[model samples]
Target: MKVINHIREVRQRKGITQIKLAEDLQVTRQTINAIEKNKYNPSLELSLKLAEYLDVPFTSLFYLDKSEENAE
Candidate 1:
């Protein structure tokens, strides 16, 4: 299964910058970038924190893709 996220879209929509989000979350901007690029998967604690910080539901921010092919 692949983990997909709408973090960039939601964050952009909310006018939140990667640096700002990272600072608020006590993480590095590279961490946010990697997560946005699908190069990293956040831990459960961080996932919950992201949802809470973005004021979005967990399902709205992240989901699973069961297909074998790449999402793109």
Candidate 2:
């Protein structure tokens, strides 16, 4: 399975920078970058914190699929 994260787009829509989001979530900018790139999946607590910070539903931030080609 593959997971996709819409963090960058959401942050852009909210007019927030990655640094700002990282600060709000108490994580590093690299962590946010990794999440956006699908290189790292956030923990449950981190996912909830991101959802709260972005003011979006958890489903809006992340998605799961069975195919790598269809994941994006």
List lDDT for all candidates, in order: 0.94, 0.89
Q: Write the per-residue lDDT of candidate 1 for residues 1-72, one digit (tens) a residue.
A: 889999999999999999999999999999999999988999999999999999999998999876756754
User: Considering only N, C-alpha and C atoms within 3 Å, which residue pairs clash in candidate 1?
Assistant: none
25-57 per-residue lDDT for model 2 (tens digits): 889999999998999989999999898888999
RMSD of each: 2.6, 2.8
- Candidate 1 RMSD to the correct structure: 2.6
Q: What is the Cα-based TM-score of model 1?
A: 0.91
Off by over 4 Å in 1: 69-72
